[model samples]
Target: MKDMLWLMRNIWRSTIRSKILPVYLMLPLLGVFLSALTYSSAEDETVLRIGVANLDKTQLAEDAVQYLDGLSHIQVQMVDLSALDGEVASGRLEGGVIFEQGFSEGVHSGKPGGLQMVSVDGEQATRHIKGLLAGYVNDLDAIARIAKGDETVFAELYNQARSKSVSLSGEMVDDISADQQKSRQSIGYLITLMLFFAMSLAGNILREKENRTYFRVLTAPITSRSYYVSNMVVHLFVMAVQVIVTLLVMRFAFRIDGGLPLWQMFVLLVIFALVAISISMVIVASARSTALATAVQSLLIVPTSLMAGCLLPIETMPAWIQKTASFLPQRWLLDTLHSLQQNGISKDVYLNISILLAFTVTFSLLAVYMFERNEDTRVFV
Candidate 1:
């Protein structure tokens, strides 16, 4: 036990001294910060500023302008036709309505209406306003017809004027918790990857063998198992620190209400980080040269990140892609974190944790076998 502790300490010291910690941590911190900024849809909440042009300026046009002005949750300003073009071009106004000359004349005569809306978007900008104006005009036109002693069509119009609308349910289509879940879940994958790469073990694995550092370490009263075990223990220790720091920063600095018990979230991340350590060990085990290590790193990083949904939105991908991703341990690891953030740990989340543990054990066992088998001390010249 004491030997394991000493070996662990030695590995920890080597890792921190390699200058990898700062680079690894800062990269993920930057990623999380950028993601936090991008994920917020606050800009979409800005109110639309609309301009109106009423040419005739009669009571009918005034009423139409007032109706447009009275639009709920929108800002309206009355401007002349000249100002309309300039303002819309300058982006000062989204768009507005223009009541043409003789609009009331056409209305009273019961002829087809005359109104011209001037804007970049011909009908789109005015569609809602047109509907409102049309409704008001339709009812008023019916009244005018009744005032003209024609009550026959009013009942017919009212009876024939049926409207259809689709009903929607209030299924938690978007839980307030989901946004934070995705954000934190992304942070988990990024931090785990950064830590895995930043350990500097892969780059140095063959370096020590070439420099006879491994020989010197072999002279120490430690078996090869102890040496590799020490590295794994130290990696796990670093993983713990990384998890704590990230979660604390997310909670206190970002103040993101990820909507779960903070402790449970932390537990989920720590377990995933352990699996990351084992993967890093595999990276080291697979390398015969730094070049080979880099090749392996590139090969694994993109595909693994894809499976983890770190590269793109997995939900937007095909069903087959999502289904295949389920086989990846990284998928389960991040899914666990997302679950923890949405709701406290459940049986399924623990199942993900178990799968991650299985991956870690499998990878570590393979790494140990490779470590034991490696006898080649040849330097890559």
Candidate 2:
């Protein structure tokens, strides 16, 4: 036990001394900041600038403008009839709503040419406003029909409709979409970094073997099993630190919520870190040389991470690719993170966790078998 602790301490020191450690820790935070910036800009895109050209100069026309202006996302500006088209076409406005002369009379008489919607971007920019304007026009048409061409009744009904009161209750929903997306992307980058770090640590076994350090260590009070166990312990410690530091920066520094408790995310990531370590062990045990191990690591980690949606969203992938990703441990880790984020604690989380553990055990066993079966691997034993 003392020897294992000593070995772990030495390995930890060596790892922390590397310049690459800082990069690994910083990349996730950088990703989170960039994601936050991108989403902040995207939020601005929701506000639409609309020009209102009211040639009718009636109560209905002004009321429509006020209604649109009162909306949360639409910004209605009163513009001249002549400038509406130019404003919309020149990209100064998203779209325009024009009320031609006699719009009220047309509404009362059930005529069609009183309203026009224009946009350079066509339906994309004007669709929502079109719907809103249609709704407004429909209400006016209903009131006009009820009055039946009586000026006094139409005016009275129009005033009543303008002052109509209905009970409405609203609750602010905290939109975690930007934060959630940032969290997912940051964690995805972290996962890839973890895998690469695991591979780097695992490669030490081959390096030490090549340099006779493994043999030298075994000649001391430590056995082969003890040395390997110490290495695994060190790997776990470094990975745990990676998870902790990255999440801390995300939560406090960036104020981004991943929609799950910090402890829950930590536990899930730690489990994945174990899987990463086991995978690295398999890569190291299967390869005869450090160069071969590196080649295999690059070939396996990036491609598998890509398939697992650690580099891209799983939803964007085709159905067949998503199915194929289900076979990967990283996919299970990410899916578990997503499940917990969306559904909180659920059966799917447990199922995915079990699968991750199963992956760890499977890879650990495979690595052991490979190490034992290899004739040129006396250093491992």
Candidate 3:
């Protein structure tokens, strides 16, 4: 016990003095800074300008134009049909809508047509306006069907629809998408850093073996397993510090509202830390030298982390790549965190936690097997 504690203290002291520790700890904050820049640039475009050209010359046509003008985040200007195309093409308007002649007559006959949309950017710029316009046409179609081709009844019913007895009021809900995205991205970067940091700590075993420190320590009363246990303790302690400090900075310092409580985030990250440690152990145990271990770490960690959506979102990847990412423990951790943030805790949280633990156990067993099979005393004593 004393021997293990002595080893643990020594490992901790060596790690604390390393300059790379600060770099690993600060990498997550870089994600936060990038997110801030992205959102700030995105906020510059707040309103959409649209041009409307109505040739129908009817009350319903005017009403449709008024509807487009009344929408939030959109500005509608009446334009001549000849000028609408030029305005949109010249970038004076994002898009344009044209209600052609007989448009109101078609609406009254329940066979609305001649509504056209034009935009340089195709559906991307016009889809929202098209959807809302479709809704207005559908309402008119419904009224025309009920009136049974009688223009007098259609007008009366439409006029009555304009003045309802009940008033409906709407309030915009607070949008937290920007905050959620920033937090998710920051944590994703942190996961990658944690894995790399764990690998660094686990590589200490290899360094000690190469330096003959492991055999020298074994000359004392400590067994190989006790020395490893001490190393694991130090590894977990550093991981905990990384997790706690990063999360604290994210919550209070950056004022990021990730929606989940701090404790939940801590629990999820700690479980992932176990997985990180286990995987690092496997890498260290499998490699015969520090150089080989580093080569393997670079080959495995960055690619797997990228696939697991630790750097970029998994959803942006191809479907096959996304499917493959599910096999990775990092993917499971990130998805679990995302689900908890979006929907709070539920039955599936337990399932995700179990899967993460399963990964840890599987990797740990594999690491033990590799360590036992390794004959190289210069790698793992």
Q: What's the lDDT for candidate 1?
A: 0.67
Error of 3 at 49 (Å): 0.8
Q: Mind giving the per-residue lDDT tens digits that candidate 2 earns over 1-381?
A: 888888888777777777777776566666667666766686675778999988999877788788899988888888998888999888889999888998878887755358788998777877888888888888878887888878789889888877889999999999998788878877887898889888877766786778767667767887655666677788898889889988998899888899999999999999999999989988887877778888998899889888888777788988999999989988888888889889999999998999999998898878767755553445343
- Which 10-residue window in model 1 sums to the lowest lDDT? 155-164
Q: Indicate which candidate wins on lDDT.
A: 3
Score residue 56 of candidate 2 by CA lDDT. 91
Model 3 agreement with the true structure over 203-306: per-residue lDDT tens digits: 77787778877567777887656665687778888888889988888888878788789999999999999999989988987877788889998999899989
**Cα deviation of 158 in candidate 1 (Å)?**
8.6
Query: Model 2: C-alpha RMSD to truth?
Result: 4.0
- Model 1: how far is 140 from its true place, Å? 12
TM-score of 1: 0.76
The lowest-lDDT stretch of 10 consecutive residues in candidate 3 is 372-381
Q: Comparing 2 and 3 by TM-score, which wins?
A: 3
TM-score of 2: 0.80
Tell me which residue pairs clash in candidate 2: none
Against the unseen true structure, what C-alpha lDDT does each candidate score? 0.67, 0.82, 0.85
The model with the greater lDDT, 1 or 2, is 2
Please report how far candidate 1 places residue 305 from its true position, in Å.
1.4
Q: Rank the candidates by TM-score, best first.
A: 3, 2, 1
lDDT of 3 at 228: 56
